[model samples]
Target: MRNLAEKPYVREEQREVQTVRRQIRKTFTRAEKGLLTLIGAAIVFSAILMVSNYASMYTQNQEISQLQNDISQQQQYNEGLEHQVSELSDPERILNIAEENGMELNEDNVRVLQP
Candidate 1:
């Protein structure tokens, strides 16, 4: 490696001097100024885009929370339905419904016919 003192300075300090010596002024024409304005607008637009992206994420998170709540309610509903089905599956309840529907239980030795 070269010594630190041997390293040449890549950055020039007197940018004004270089411009003056080269007779190149940093003057902006109307179109150039408008282009710079457009670049600034693009930067602001990107910031708005970042904020809107986060906002949409927040909205989706809220939706997911609501869906989770709905799922919990559905689980409770399913549990209630399971309890009702269990209650209705008792032998007495089955015989009651069958009698109401005009059906009879078949004995092992009985032969049944349908029309």
Candidate 2:
């Protein structure tokens, strides 16, 4: 059987221990708090870096797409100019234009140069 005289003393000691345990459980250690703060800061920094890189990549892709469109337009314009050049340089077209202007081609007036 337990000692009846020590029962109240043991109950008081148990209440004090429970109070200390509750206080300890309610507060974080300083090192643990610092570590948690550092982890949160790292997560925020990583998110910022990821967003910045994504924006940079998106801008570059848009520029590249615009440049490709410019190249396609320039190529089409160059092809049109090539067709005009071929038409303007045609011998039959040149002869018709000269005839309209009252110009004649004489075999005796033609001189050939050898390279």
Candidate 3:
């Protein structure tokens, strides 16, 4: 039969052992905590750097696309100007303009220039 009124006697040695066990249960040492903090900071920094690089690359790609569009438009404009030049430089158009301005063409005095 157990006596319920009497409290269990805990020895000082046992108490000390229990305290040690509680201390042992602590998950991380100070150095391990510092290392974990450093690792976490590094991961955050890497993420930020990667985002920054991606943004920069995206901006550059957009700029390149705009430049390509501009170049294509300019090329089309240049082709238009070239067509106009070719049309305006036709010998018949030139002769018509000259005759409208009361100029006579002398084939004997005309010289053709070769490129």
Candidate 4:
């Protein structure tokens, strides 16, 4: 009965020693803390890089959209100018303008060009 009582005390002491060892193991070393801090900083830098890249892409897209709109407007204005040119270049209108300027049409000197 006395030996059995001593065994329980010994077991309790062993348990306390193991608990203390586990606590000690849970604490971080200096090198491990530095490694963790480096990894955290790297993660933050990568996140900032991604956000900046996205912002740059967004700004470029807006510029491209604006350039496309300007090109479309210029194309429409060019089409309008082409239509006006065609109206002004009618053969009948040219003949009337020549007559109004006191010019005579001689068929012998007239040249008809085909496109």
Candidate 5:
């Protein structure tokens, strides 16, 4: 029919007009292009900063963990040395050693020194 042919032609013309409108909308002005470029750069810079901060934090945490382990090992070693010192300085052990060396305990000859 004649109307059916005209309908197809009208739809084609409408489609062409919409395509031209979309192309015009897609075109950006100089100022808009500059603003978009600045926004993209800012996003990239922020991402870089975030990654750098995370790396720094991770490194610091690892250092702290290693230091804690070192401190724990040092404390354990110090405690062991302190126990040995206490055992060596026992009064009974000192008396036995003095007897073995033929030294007698003389309270009157002992002098107390104060710091």
Candidate 6:
């Protein structure tokens, strides 16, 4: 402050203005902006994919359950058919069917075939 304008300062006489200084500057161009947008879109897409996967898994489980129920019903139906077959063991049904086709029950009238 003595004579800054009248005399020149020495090289080591100048004092430091600040102990530390920090500054941050950010700049965005069209390409950088587009990159940020793409990143955001990718995050959203990932979320959608996760939701879709969960939905597919849930639907598959439901389908499996329905198929198991269908199998149980079909098994019951087959068992009922088997029971009916066991009950119809009388020879009268066969004789009636044979007579309807004009087939006689005589020993010579029957043809024997073996496989």
Q: How much lDDT does each candidate structure score?
A: 0.91, 0.91, 0.94, 0.91, 0.92, 0.89
Better of 5 and 6 by lDDT: 5
Location of the lowest summed lDDT over 10 successive residues in candidate 6 = 1-10
* Better structure of 4 and 5 per lDDT: 5
TM-score list, all predictions: 0.54, 0.67, 0.75, 0.75, 0.75, 0.56
Candidate 2 vs candidate 6: which has greater lDDT? Answer: 2
Runs off by more than 4 Å, candidate 2 = 1-27, 108-115
Which stretches of model 4 miss by more than 4 angstroms? 1-25, 113-115
| Candidate 4: tens digits of C-alpha lDDT, residues 1-112 | 4675454543334434343434445789999999999999999999999999999999999999999999999999999999999999998999999999999999999888
Please report, as a residue range, the 10-residue window in candidate 2 with the lowest summed lDDT: 10-19
* Candidate 1 wrong stretches, greater than 4 Å: 1-26, 92-115
Q: Would you give me the overall lDDT of model 4?
A: 0.91
**Residue 84, model 4, lDDT:** 93
Q: Residues 1-115, candidate 6, lDDT per residue (tens digit)?
A: 5775776755777776876767867789999999999999999999999999999999999999999999999999999999889768556888888899997789777777788
What value of lDDT does candidate 3 attain over all alpha carbons? 0.94
The stretch of ten residues in a row with the least summed lDDT in candidate 4 is 10-19
